[model samples]
Target chain A: MLGAATTPAEARAAFRGGAVRPTAGIAAGYVQCNLLSLPAADAFDFLLFAQRNPKPCPIIEVLEAGQLESEVMPGGDIRRDVPAYRVFRDGELVDEVADVSEVWRDDLVSFLIGCSFTFESALLDAGVPVAHIDQGRNVPMYRTNVPTRPAGRFSGPLVVSMRPMPAAQVADAVRITSRYPSVHGAPVHVGDPAAIGIEDISRPDFGEAVEIAEGEIPVFWGCGVTPQAAVMASKPEFAVSHAPGHMLITDLKDSDFQVP
Target chain B: MLGAATTPAEARAAFRGGAVRPTAGIAAGYVQCNLLSLPAADAFDFLLFAQRNPKPCPIIEVLEAGQLESEVMPGGDIRRDVPAYRVFRDGELVDEVADVSEVWRDDLVSFLIGCSFTFESALLDAGVPVAHIDQGRNVPMYRTNVPTRPAGRFSGPLVVSMRPMPAAQVADAVRITSRYPSVHGAPVHVGDPAAIGIEDISRPDFGEAVEIAEGEIPVFWGCGVTPQAAVMASKPEFAVSHAPGHMLITDLKDSDFQVP
Candidate 1:
């Protein structure tokens, strides 16, 4: 197993070599992105969907058809960069593969979207404690009643990640995260669970729940899972996405997403 | 003539009533946009181009194929919303009409992009003196060597608008405009005009030139005319855009585009 001390290149090589199993916190200070791959016929709509919902789908880079390697991240192979990929047929998960080389097609278009991990670093830097990092658990995520802007056949409710922060540091959290719009910008909602239709904050739709201390407010941010929910709702004939928590590490620095 | 006192609804109503004139400073506080209408076949490429060059082309709303009215701005007819429309055929200027009702087709896709007027309000609010607004001249613009990120069938050098500001106020000007990313955002280049390929700032490629006073720097922001230049360069089968300064006044407020 590759440890957290490995360089991004070494980490990617390990993943390609079937040594790294999941990329939760392997390479620090680098960007880890969610992947969405679809056919050319659905590319325009998916692109438009991301454009309309930038908060949930902040695009880091888009790979045009027939291009496997990202121009921004040279030597990174789209087919083998990540630890795992999930193949979906009509929105149903059919297979989980270590490599997607055989299923790769000329018509495939890829999108790299910003992940919440970018802002989690900012939170930690600002002295705000992250519950999941301390407990070695997944960050809580939930499907909300918030409706995303419909584009073509893609239309669904928004998905959000939850983090319990002390009320005193909520403002600082907002300020720091707002600087990184390319990653899920600022908090969509703070202090309330019923408002966004998340009936149970302790029980999440995805990821393990973490402890919320007294005087801490539960904050919500647009999640990368949003596009996946949209894809599942749309029921496209074919699609591929990185398995949850198995992100493709990019060459981009966390500061690249910051606004001046 | 629609005056600054006129309401947005009244101005749009007047525009639809054959009031074929420029829409500059007509509806105060409302967002105005540059229009780009293209065949559905070319919609994907144009959308991608706008996505890549957001500073020059901040897409406010995109009316999909067969849609006549924008969902964001209700009851507004795109076919006759703007005061004037310039039609291009095979990349050449073919006609300038008051309305595109006769030429409108079902396969057409319309994109409404942010205009500088949205950010000019921000500059004025910040007490930055706008020379063109005071002297009653159109903001000077020029084509520069700064190349835009090209998408399918679209590629060209960037176009920028120049505003002369006292050296001391340049920072304030940048700080204010950076808030409105939907409206050309911040300055792409500040200082020496020749460095960005503008040999003479006095002689602009579009709009009347304004005099640069002593201790002033020529600050340049990406211009909305970039898409028009790219469309002309790409030589598409057919395209339609708003004539200079004749923009589509949207229901969105200038304050709405502000970051915080």
Candidate 2:
């Protein structure tokens, strides 16, 4: 749910005003993040988990107990800021809701994780064509053999998103994305999927698969959805995440995260 | 105490044989790290602290409790690999020794942290002159107003190392170092040092001060010594660290850590 507005506050207001939809392609220059809210008791462990596995869970901001608004993203409310949210209880999908205000707890901690959407914009600006966006579909994702470091009870195989591009552009794509470490920066796997235990590239465990043209190499990046998978596997008492494709928009400009 | 050895294994062997000297310029191209060995009781918390504050404590490898050698760095023994060791009891420096084998306990966990020396070499190779290296002295460091994200009992002010370079080379220096996140990627602050709470650039809180020319700007990088400072402040019952400049050399090459 978005308008011609360029500010994060405006986007949040639109979402709060019954505009329930995915957040893709909204507020082009700003950052869109993945949301993860968990109990305070589990906060430290989860934060450590994210830290140990930064490529999968690059934290942008962490909200303290009972704090719904982020100090980093001022005036942004977590309760109703995201367009859509998925609630999980004991690791099972309980319901998809527009707002989580009813079940909000004072002891809950919220984490804003970097999404690939920021770097995807960078790739596009650098003349690197993204296949999924061109085909009007979700980027292909797969469960790889790569194991994530276990922190407390959180541990699972890494999840990666795949994009196919020419060998020459791969280097340029890497250079552009590496500047934004807050997002999943650089490719995790560059060539064959079989090397990482992916049997067929066409059939993905998650998201729609895109065609890999001749002379194109399949490149993979650590996915933002990895923490959600970890939470599901850990089976925490309660967890909430932005629904797939739906994201929380923040006031931070993409350029603010650039290294130089 | 170094001899005509050209390999990391040889360097470790020399150190193990009672070498108590600075590791600067030795074992060129191999990765050298700052060591932090603490009791198992504080292992998780210390790791969390490092994860929460990666800019200062970029973890290269973590050895489990009671483990000395690392799979990541083969044939290297932690107990006597470093040129020198400093023992701290209740936050007080009790002793500095060439080897810690006698005091080594089964409950101790080792953390290998990225040192700024790695990136400094990268900067110099990129033709960005390092002021401290040119003068044959330690890089100046200062306690800053920037606060680190506290985890468990570990927290303190950020300590940054300074290098004076012309304004034109700042961008290139940032780009080159940013690719090596394992080595305190990029400059944390540039231009005004007073903004970060540095009272005097001439007299540093740690290390030797170098002359900052009129056209040059003082660039600050997150230092590896930050964890030692935090550990000292936290007053842990038992802790160990490599003597200043007496780093632990690993088999990893500097190019191995580049993001692309």
B86-159, model 2: which lDDT tens digit per residue?
99998888999999999998988888999887887788888999998899998898888898888667888899
Clash pairs, candidate 2, are none
What tens digits encode model 2's per-residue C-alpha lDDT throughout A65-173? 6777865567767988898999999989899999999988888888899999989888998899999999999889998888888866688889999999998899988
In the range A1-260, model 1's lDDT, one tens digit per residue, is: 46566677777777788754668777788889999999988888888899899999998888888888865567878888888998888988888998888898889889899999988988898898888888889989999999999999899989999888888988998998998888999988998899999998889998889999989999899999998898889988888899888998877788777786
**Which is the leading candidate under lDDT?**
1
Candidate lDDT values, in order: 0.88, 0.85
lDDT of 1 at A223: 96
